[model samples]
Target: MNDQYELLDSGNGKKLERYGDIILDRPCAQAVWAPRNPGLWETATASFDRVGGLNWEGRSKVSKAWNVEIAGVVMKLSATDFGHIGVFPETRSLWQWIRSALREQAQTKGRELKFLNLFAYSGGATLAAAQAGAQCCHLDASKGMVEWARENAKLNGLQDAPIRWIVDDVIKFLRREVKRGNRYDGILLDPPSFGRGKKGELYKIEDQLMTTLDLVHEVLSEDPAFVLLTSHTPGFSPIVLGNLLRQYHQSGTFECGEMLLTGKPGVNELPNGNWACWINTFS
Candidate 1:
C-alpha cells in the first residue's frame, strides 16, 4: 500500500485516514476498539456527519476530486454524495494478486488472459488486470461509477486498454454471458451487503449471493485461472465463501483469510474484509 493511503487511527466507532495528504474521519462500525490516538481524530481535516443523510464537516484542504496511485496505477478519487470517498483502499491486495497471476501466466505459458470484474468501482481491479496485460470486462450497476472508472482508466493511461465498461445488474449480466457462452479466465466480484440495480432491482447479499455464484459458475472457463470472492458484511465468514467454491469444481486449491490494512504507529492491522479464493491449474 502507498503511504498516501494509510489508516492513521481507528477505533471508537470511527476511523481516521490519509488519502494523498488529506486526512478524513469516517464512521467505521467495525472499529469497536478504543482509539489509540484521540488527538489524531480531533485534528482530522474533515469528518463525515451522518445525521439523516450524510455530510462532511471541519476545515478541508482537499478538493471535490483528487488522485492517488496504487502500484503505479493512478486512480481519481472524489467525495461523492455517498458517504464513501471514491477509491476503496482495502482492495489493493486483490489488485496485486490479479496482476501477479497475469504476469506468472505470461511467463509460464505466454497465454492471453481475460477477466470479468463485477462491481468494479473506479476501475481499481480492472486497471490492475489491464496493466498486467489482460483483457477485462468491468461491470457495475451504476452509470456514474462506470463513468468514474473510465476517468480513472484515462488517468492511468489505459484509456485505450482492452476493457469493456458495462453498466448493468451483475446477475443479469452473468446470465446473459452464460446464454452467449461467454467465458472468462478469471472472475472477481465484491458484492455489497445491500444494493439496488439500475432498474430498481434489489440485491441482498445474504439472500442472493449463492444464486449469483451459481450463475457465475456457468460462465467461468473450463480451465479458469482463478475466482475471487470478497465481502465486508458482518457475520459472513471467509469459510462460507470457501465452501461456495466447492460447487464450482470437484478439486481445486482454496484459500481464505482476512484482508486488512496496516494501521499507523500504534495499530497494526485493521480488518477491512474477508476473502475466499480458488486457483484452478488444470486444463
Candidate 2:
C-alpha cells in the first residue's frame, strides 16, 4: 500500500499515486462512478485492495514508509490508526500557523519559548516549533507514533536535541503537567473526530472538545505565544473551534479559520482542513 498518497492524477474511481519507488493504482471513495483508466491503472506502484486498509498490488519493492516535506521540515509519515497518515499533507496549513505564532512571539518577547503539542502524532508541528526556537514537548498516546516523530526529528538532523518525546495519553500528561506547575507559551492541538484514549478516556471532539479546550486553557501561561486548534472532524467548524477558545481562554485576540492549501487552481487548490488561531494580543 502507498504510505504517502502522492496524488499523481485523481479522477473518477481512482487516484494514481507515486509512493517511494512504487506507484499506486487504487479506487477512491470520492471518485464514485468515475471513468476507469485501464492504462494508468497498470502503472500502479501498489494499490490498497479495499476501503480504509493498506493492502497492496504490483511488485512493491520498498518497505511501508512515507515522508512529507513542508517548509524545510521533513515529516516521516505512516498509518498509525485505521488508515490515517499521522502527519497528513492537509496539516501543512496548521504547521504554518504554529510557525507564525512562534516567530511573532520570539520577536516580541525577545526570548525563546516552550511548546506543548497534544495529539502530536508524528511531530510535524513539533519540528516546526523546535526549529523556530521553542523547546517542544511532543505528546501522543501511541508509542509507534512517537517513534515516527523521533525519526522525523532525526531526518531533519534534530536528534539528541532538547525535544522531549512523551508517549502517553494527552489528557493524563497535561493533568500532570498542570499539577507540577509546568506551562507552555505555545500550544498546538489536532484532535481526532471520535476516539478513545489509551486508558479509554473517551474523546468525542463534538462532546469533549469544549472541556478539553478549558483544560488546555488552564495550562497556558498568562503570556502565551499562540493557541492553535486544527480539527479534521467532518462536523467541527473552524468558527466553533474559535468560539471554544474564546469561551475558555477569554484572553488574547482569538481568530479561527480553515487552513487553506496554497496551489494552482486545478488539482490542489482547496483548503484541506480547519484551524483556529488565538494570539495573546494582551501586550
Candidate 3:
C-alpha cells in the first residue's frame, strides 16, 4: 500500500482523499451519512461537484496530472471529468491477496501462473500480477485506457514483462480466447455496471454478469488458483457475487465482503465496493 493515498473524510454524499500530494473531494453515492468533520472539507484542494454533469471546484497547488505508486504499481492520476483520480485505493487488499496467492503457488507448485484481467483499467491488477511473477493478459474496451496502462507499465520498468495489453470487449476477448484454447490459472474482474464496448455493444451488469462468469469458467485452467470478482454497482451485493461464483465453482473457499477504506478525519469505514473471491484448494 502507498502511504501517499489516504481517505481523509467521507460523508454527505462525498469523499475527501489525499492522492500523493494532492487533496481532492469527490462525490460518493454510498456516503449517505452526515459528515462528522465538516471543518476538514474547507481545506480540500479541489472537489468534484455533480451538477448537470460533473465539475471540479476549488483550486489545487498540485498538478492536474501526476503519478503515484500503489502496491509497486505506478499509475498516472488526473482529475478527470468522471470524478476519479485514476487510482482505486480500496483495491490494495485485493492486490495483496493476489500477490500472496501467486507467491505461494510459485513456491509450492513450481510454476509461473497465468492471469487474465477483465476490464483492466490503467493496468493496476495487471502490474500486480506481473510483479508477482504471473504472465497476464489485460483486456479493456477503451483505447485511451489501454494506452494509459501501457504508460504505467513503462513507468514500472515492466516494458519487457509478459503482459499482453488487449483493447477489446471483455466478453468478446474471452470468447476468442476460448476458441484459441487459451486458459489462465488466475482471473481478476472489475466489470462496470453499465458500459459500451468499442463497437457500442451494450453491457448491463444485471443481464450480463452471469453469462460473463460462465465464459470466464470456460477459459480457466484445470488447476485453477484464484478468482477475484468485484463490482461497484449499487444493487450488486457480496451475496450476489458469491452466488455467481458458486454457480460455476461448487467447492472452493468463497469469501465475500464489502471493500472499505477508513477515512482519516472521522475514522469512518467507507464502503467502496463489494467483492467475492475464490481460492481453489481442491485442485
Candidate 4:
C-alpha cells in the first residue's frame, strides 16, 4: 500500500495539509527554526497557532469530514480538538499489512483468525480486519477516539458492526483478558511514548514495552495470525522494535520488516519518528 505523506510545506512551527479539500493547519515541532517557503503558508485555509490552546484562522467554515485517497484506499479524514488524525494516512501500510497478514495466516492454518487491536485509535486497522472477515476487538484509552472510530465505521456503513470497542488502558485490558482466558489470532499495538493510566499508573514505553509484549504473547493463540507493533517515539528505531520482537520469538520463526516512511514532493526527508514490527507465524 502507498502511504501518502505529502509535506506540502512547513515553517514557523506550523505545517499545512491539503487532504481532500479539508486543508488542515497544524502545529509541527519539526518546522522549528525556519520557514518552509514564502508562498505555501499564505494559502492555508487554517493556521493552528500554538499557544494557550491551539487557535484557528480561516475564512470559510471548513467541514469536519472529508475523503482522502491514500495508498489507493478511500479513507475518511477529520480534525478534532485533540490535534490527532486517528486515521493517519501514513498508517496505510499498517492497514494493508494487517489484512494481508490475517488472510495469509488463515489460509495457512486452515481456520479463521481473530484479530485484536489495542490502543486502536480511530480504527483503521480494525476496519481493515473487519473487512477481511476477521473477528476483531478495538480497544482504546480515549472514549473520543472510539467514537471517531465508530464514525469511520459508520462512514463505511459499518454501523452495528461486529467489532468490539473497549475504553480502557491497553495494558490493563490485556491483563484482564489474559485472566479471562481471552485469546486472539492476531494483535495490533501502537504504544505511546509516555502516558499515565486513568488511575495515576505510569507508563513509560522504554521501561514497560517488553514486559507488555511478554504479557501479550500469553494472549496469542498457538496457531496465530501475527502481532504488529508500531512506535513514533523519537529515539526508537525500526531495529529497536525488531530486536524487541526478536526477544519474544522463542522459536525465531517470524517474518519481520522495517517500516519505510515517505513524504510528498520537495518537502523534506522521511521524518525520523516511527517504527513498526509485523510478525507472522511461518508454519
Alpha-carbon local distance difference test for all models: 0.84, 0.71, 0.85, 0.71
lDDT of 3 at 107: 72
What is the per-residue lDDT of model 2 for residues 1-283, given as tens digits with 9 covering 90 to 100? 1133344555565555553445555554444444334466666655655555555544344345666566557766443224344556557656666777788888898887889999888888899888777888998877877888999999888897679999876777777888999888988898888766777777777777776777788888767878888887775688887876777666668877766433323443334568887887885
TM-score computed on alpha carbons, candidate 1: 0.94
Pairs that clash in candidate 2 = 12-34, 22-45, 23-44, 23-45, 23-46, 24-45
Ranking by TM-score: 3, 1, 4, 2
- Of models 1 and 2, which has the larger TM-score? 1
Candidate 1 per-residue lDDT, tens place, 1-283, comes to 4436778888878888888778888887788999888887877888886777788785355687888886567878777656687877777878889999877765665688889999887888999899989989999999999999999999989999999999998999889999999999888999999998878889999888998999888888766788999998887788987888877777778888888766556674678888999887665
Residue pairs clashing in model 1 are: none
| lDDT for residue 93 in candidate 4, whole number 0-100 | 72
In candidate 1, stretches whose alpha carbon ends up further than 4 angstroms from where it belongs are 1-3
Model 1 global lDDT (CA atoms, 0 to 1): 0.84
Q: What is the C-alpha RMSD of each candidate to the true structure, in Å?
A: 1.7, 4.1, 1.6, 3.2
Better of 1 and 2 by lDDT: 1
lDDT for residue 224 in candidate 2, whole number 0-100: 83
Q: In model 4, where do residues sit more than 4 Å from their true spots?
A: 1-5, 11-14, 31-38, 67-76, 198-200, 252-269
Q: Name the lDDT of candidate 2.
A: 0.71
Q: Which ten residues in a row have the lowest lDDT in candidate 2?
A: 261-270
